[model samples]
Target: TQLLEQSPQFLSIQEGENLTVYCNSSSVFSSLQWYRQEPGEGPVLLVTVVTGGEVKKLKRLTFQFGDARKDSSLHITAAQPGDTGLYLCAGRDTGGFKTIFGAGTRLFVKA
Candidate 1:
């Protein structure tokens, strides 16, 4: 099993604001993923970073993988009430099927 640590466990922002959440770990992963979740439902896959120094964008959201393949970050621009939810990061083991998740960042956006 891999371990990922997420920062700023909670965030509250006003509409149109911007925010970034970070995930860090000492172990390298074959691939890492980011997810967004709403109340009473399963999380939705946002992006997956598989290579070192790779970056991906989903609309106003940006995701980056560390050069060492051991860390990642997610940035969201122009926050909205609809964007409010729990953001999570997971790392897949390089040699097995194990996947580990951070506790998650709960975001609250006020309109």
Candidate 2:
């Protein structure tokens, strides 16, 4: 079975701090996606990196895909209060349309 495991289930930091979150799995994924969800809202796609060793950036956020396609990472720089939210990583299985989600990392950024 394909499964994704995420680390550092929670994070709290002051404004301008930097942090990193990891997602790992033993199973290979065809594509991996990262999302950020705010209070009372569904997760919105932050980025999708399909190729191995791929890196994508959005403003202060950076995302990287493992060379083995079984892991991924998210790095946030100069985090602001508005950056506080739930960060999730999901993998899409080629065998089916189903996608497996990680436990999620909840971030709290203080002003």
Candidate 3:
């Protein structure tokens, strides 16, 4: 079984719609990162949340880390066609050196 299985694994929406993606885990990480990726290209870092209970916003994107540092969520406002891509959440365990990723969320924003 996968350690991280994000919710609503696949999403298809219309342009200008808003959606939220979630990452839940029983493990706690020292830091967590969010990324957006396209076909054949590397993931593009959106933001990293380290401090528990921290919230960060970039343009229409909003990211949050759980107060226990065991979970995270991403919310996108006014979704655009450009937002169509794969969204991923990854983090390293409190003691582990390697980073593990939650099953990616595939978003399809239609015009």
Q: RMSD, each candidate, Å?
A: 0.9, 0.9, 1.4
| TM-score of model number 1 | 0.96
TM-score winner between 2 and 3, please give it.
2
**TM match of model 3 to true structure:** 0.95
Estimate TM-scores for all models: 0.96, 0.96, 0.95
Instruction: Supply candidate 2's per-residue lDDT for 44.
Output: 96
lDDT of 3 by residue, 1-109 (tens): 2266688899999999999999988888898999889999999899999999999999999999999998899999999999999999998788758788988999999
Cα lDDT over the full model 2:
0.94
In model 3, which regions exceed 4 Å deviation?
Answer: none
Provide the lDDT at 94 for model 3: 81
Instruction: Quantify how close model 1 is to the true structure by its C-alpha RMSD in Å.
Output: 0.9
lDDT of 1 by residue, 21-99 (tens): 9999999999999999999999999999999999999999999999999999999999889999999999998885888
Give the range where candidate 3 is weakest over 10 consecutive residues by summed lDDT: 1-10
The sequence of per-residue lDDT tens digits that candidate 2 reaches over residues 38-109 is: 989999999998999999999999999999999999999999999999999999987758998999999999
